[model samples]
Target chain A: EDKVVQSPLSLVVHEGDTVTLNCSYEVTNFRSLLWYKQEKKAPTFLFMLTSSGIEKKSGRLSSILDKKELFSILNITATQTGDSAVYLCAVGKSNTGKLIFGQGTTLQVKP
Target chain B: DVKVTQSSRYLVKRTGEKVFLECVQDMDHENMFWYRQDPGLGLRLIYFSYDVKMKEKGDIPEGYSVSREKKERFSLILESASTNQTSMYLCASSPTVSEQYFGPGTRLTVT
Candidate 1:
């Protein structure tokens, strides 16, 4: 079975602090890795990383995939209270639209 | 923008009752999926359909069934609502092997 694990299940940081959340996975025919942010309702897409070493960024959030290491990391720079949410990492397999998601890292940013 | 819509935001049902959760996507995607989200479980796929009338079991398919009568709509049915089935249900759709668009989840509570 494909599995994705995330590190530091929960983190607390003050505003302007930087946080890095980790996700590692084991799957066959790996395709892409996706990041999402969930506050109260549904999760919103953050970034999608396909190639190793190449980083995908959006404002204060950036993510990179290390295929060789079978892991990915999501970085939030200059965090704000609005960034407090559950950050989820999901892996998609080749030729299938199915996604295996990590347990998610809960980030709490205090002002 | 792609839009995924769920029928309800919150639902409460008695044990043994038959419950149905509806989901619809407006992007005319060929693949639709149903997932349940829990505190520590992230997202567990219940079932998915690649085409109309085509269904496949996912990682956690027990106690859940799905229907894809139309290309744009997928419905998840719980044969008998149980306390263990209480969770936030999410629906997603994708065109191919791309990132999925998710609906605002439906929170179900079984009493």
Candidate 2:
């Protein structure tokens, strides 16, 4: 079965701390991997990585994919209380619009 | 900006009752998806539609049905709600087979 696994199911960090979350997948015909942040109501898009080695970044968040290892990682630097939320990772299959997601890492950023 | 909206934020229904969760997107996306999120289980795909009236079952589609009568709307139906079906139902839309935009989600409680 196509599955995505995320490590450190939960993380507690202080403000300004840096945290790295991991995601690994076993799927048929891997295409792309995506990250999302869920705060209150919905989950917002973070990044989508299709190629390996290259990294994608926004403000304080960055992510990279490793196709050879069948995994990906999302790094958040300078964490704040606002960054306390569940981070989700998903893998998409080639030619399929469907996505398989991991359990997510619930991050708690203390002030 | 792409906007996906769910009809409800929280809903309470009794077992054996029929339930409907509606999702609408403003970006005129070609794909729509329905997923259930649970603690430890992550997000499990229930169903998806690539185009209007074209539906495909995902990993878990038992006891569930979907409708996509128009381009912007997708509906998930529970013919007979059960306690196991209580979960956070998420709706998402995508332009192609890539990045997806999600809605606020609907928390369904079956009693």
Candidate 3:
């Protein structure tokens, strides 16, 4: 069975702090791993990592995947209260386009 | 930009009642997915449609049905609503098999 696990189910950080969220997966025929941020209602796309040891970044957010290790990490620098939300990780299959999602990491950035 | 929309932001249904949740995407995406979100469980896929009229069962498809009669619209049906079915339902669409865009979720409550 394919499974995705996220560590540090919940975290508390102050503004301007840097936090790293981890996600590990065990899936057959893994094609890509994706990260999302959910604030209130919807989850917005963060990044999709398909290559090992390569980093994808946008502003204060960055992510990297280790395909060889079957894990991924999302880093947020200079965290703010607006960054408080649940971060999700999902793994996709190349053949079926199916995705298996992790339990998510809830981040609370205090002002 | 891709936009995904759901029929309702909140819904209340009684046990044994039939419920329908609708999703529409404006990007003419080839893949549409339905998932339920719960505390501690993250997102569990209920069903997915790769093309018009082509539907596939996802990880958690029991007590649910799906319809994709058109390219931009997908619907999820709860045959008989139960307390266990109360959850936040999310809709997502993808161009191929990656980088999914999500919609504002519908919170369903069965009492």
lDDT of 3 by residue, A1-111 (tens): 999999889999999999999999999989999999999978998999999999999999999999888999999999999999999999999876678999999999999
CAPRI-style quality class for the chain A–B interface of candidate 2:
high
Instruction: List, residue by residue over A4-93, the lDDT tens digit for candidate 2.
Output: 999999999999999999999999999899999999778898999999999999999999999999999999999999999999999989
Q: Which residue segments of model 1 deviate by more than 4 Å?
A: none
Compared with the true structure, all predictions reach lDDT values of: 0.94, 0.95, 0.95
Best by DockQ: 1
Candidate 1 structure quality by residue, lDDT tens digits, A1-111: 789999889999999999999999998999999999999988888888999999898888889999999999999999999999999999999999999999999999999
Model 3 chain B worst lDDT run, 10 consecutive residues:
B93-102
**Residue A92 error for model 1, in Å?**
0.4
iRMS of every model, one decimal?
0.6, 0.7, 0.9
Tens-digit lDDT track of model 2 for B11-97: 999999999999999998999999999999988999999999999999899999999999999999999999999999999999998
For candidate 2 chain A, the 10 contiguous residues with the lowest summed lDDT are A36-45
C-alpha DockQ for predicted model 2: 0.87
> Once superposed on the true structure, which residue ranges of model 2 sit more than 4 Å away at CA?
none
Weakest lDDT window of 10 consecutive positions for candidate 3 chain A: A92-101
Clash pairs detected, candidate 1 = none
* TM (chain A) per model: 0.98, 0.98, 0.98
Query: If both were scored by lDDT, which would come out higher, candidate 1 or candidate 3?
Result: 3
RMSD of 3: 0.8
Second chain alone, TM-score for each candidate: 0.99, 0.99, 0.98
Q: How high is the lDDT of residue A94 in model 3?
A: 85
